[model samples]
Target: MADHRRPPPDILVIGAGLAGIACALDLSRAGLSVELLESSDGVGGRMRTDRKDGFLLDRGFQVFNTAYPQVKRRVSLRDLCLRPFTPGLLARTSTRLVRIADPIRRPGDAASLMPGRVLSARDLAALAALTTRDVLLPASILKRLPDRSTAAALTRAGISLSAAEELLRPFLSGVFLEDELETSARFFHMVWRSMARGNLCLPAAGIGAVPEQLAAGLPDGTLRLEAPVVTVTDSGVLLQDGSERPASTIVVATDGPTAACLLPGLTVPDGRTVTTYYHAADTSPLAEPTLVVDSSRAVLNTCVLTEVAPSYAPPGTALVSTSVLNDDRPGGEAVVRRRLAELYGTDTSAWTLIGAYIVEDALPAMVPPWPVSRTTRFAPDRYVCGDHRATGSVQGALASGTRAAREVLADLARQ
Candidate 1:
């Protein structure tokens, strides 16, 4: 039997998302008594996965980047059994489908990048220079560059407008979840650099497996699920069931909106909404593990998940994932299905609708002049951390949590 009159824990982490998990893990490893509470039955807030009818559908279309420094620090890549996507894109333009490949990664595919295929000689040279600077130059130097929209940054980099519109806009829009390419130039450069330096892959199990792995590392009795916190006071959090959990310190590590609800006046950025549709196909539309983007901006991006990792689908069936900006329209799935057929140049009529997920606050917007990181300490003992406080990525979430843990440790040491 547990002691009901015991003292409160040293740290109480609200939310079991990546940020909360990372913070709690760090605090516990440092010999602190921590209590991590989650409202949901499982972990991974936006990074969730659904298993239905032998198909694995992620909450939204997501990819794991191997170049994330935080991910490399916390996760074992080998344990995830990651499957890499091709280091290029199959872009659909007004005229034809363009095949773009990284010459450094695929030397034999270099011919596909010749002038007039996807980009002009001048544009290609400019792109090469930009890639070299981003991938080879130090991040400290890139961070020092002027803060501006990604579109303006590309123009300044000497990339032609044609190349920007045809290739960069379509591809990067999928990444930033905005079609205008108006995200922060520093953030864009870092994303591009990561792609250039590492491979984009998927876990053999599902995207949710990433957070599950993080949760598995925590010490027993530290995590409590289905423990919805109604309010957070200076002392601790109050549950909806009229139960109060007292703690010496608290960390709010939830989504942008939820965090704002808990900590009033906490500025939460406007988030990007996305809808992903999963379809079970008899066969994959494309044989290769490449992402297809539409230059017309009809849909954000589409890929055959089974092609990337055969384990994502059952035997003899393919799982296709399509993502589009959420517009709250009727019969949107039907419209997307038609577009998918056109993009793949195959009949999608027979494809079965496996699942559809519409995420309201998928990611925080990273507009120009945005601070790449923010202060995590809210008060003497209260703190807040999430991707919203950083660059709106898994890396940001993990990094922010790590920062919060360091702040807590430092404050405790001072005491």
Candidate 2:
């Protein structure tokens, strides 16, 4: 049932995902008559909640870092009510479990990055120096180079090979979500800036709340749920149910390819899939709420479930989520379980597998020099928005949405 009684908007926003919501939120705040549309029944898109027998689970385990500048500027953390995790991480090496901490804070713990484990002092130093290069000297430093892969530039800067895999690879690759060798150093630096910002926290309620909040503050008739947008012609936009939504501007605020579909021949990257593995456990295997990585395993990274948001799980339960890279893994559950046993010294028989979402084609293939020429590719009156448009992750999506809004506004002002 479509809510077609409302008046058409000055700006029609397609897709109700985080990016779309963020754009709509800002546009409406500016007093623009905006109408947001969603293909799905819910507003959150990939970020909706799943209510089970008693537990409220997220579509995927989503974490927000204090580093995301757009999130901090756009929404208040207190309003959403986030839960913070412990500052340290638990890294499980082959021999034993190790708790890594900032030496200044936890002086009692192991002094090295690996923590509670022995490393060749030389390797440790190399790793530390490599991190300093990636973290401190990010994209802003490489602004001069408009064209070149950042990974190669890092190598040129003398980041050692072993150091790349052991240290830089784990951190940078996880942040960028792809092959280390191919990524641009500029993008790497962008990720580093985020890392330098602050703590990483997940929503106590659910990631969907973030978008829901954005959509909530909108005035009545500003949003249309379950409205499948069919086309974006020269005059205006079209709806799925044979209705035309004519507007001064149409925001193609959708994932990369989805936008391309509406406005044919839009040149965006081919989307890739991601598998999010959620394991509910009686006790968390990893220490603290910090993120863990196994570079050798190609398992992007894992985080402590209970530490970030205690409410994610019911009484005495821990929620573990692992987000894979661009490619899809068929047997993610079994693979995650095997990896868990290898690290935690336990089997999957004990833990309850609550949610395992596999977006066969989740995000677009971002092969660095990202934030590509989306402005040129999209239709004149309709702008695109999503993680893949500019950057990736929560902040990336936020930025994309804001960018779309800004672009649309500029066009309107000129007209």
lDDT of 1 by residue, 258-329 (tens): 999998888888999999999999988999999999988879999999999998889999999999988477
lDDT of each: 0.90, 0.68
The deviation in Å at residue 329 for candidate 2 is: 5.5
- Cα misplacement distance, residue 353 of candidate 1 (Å): 0.6
Q: Where is the poorest 10-residue window by lDDT in model 2?
A: 368-377
Structural similarity to truth (TM-score) of each candidate = 0.97, 0.86
Best by lDDT: 1
Report lDDT (Cα) of residue 114, candidate 1: 94
Top TM-score model: 1
How high is the lDDT of residue 211 in model 2?
80
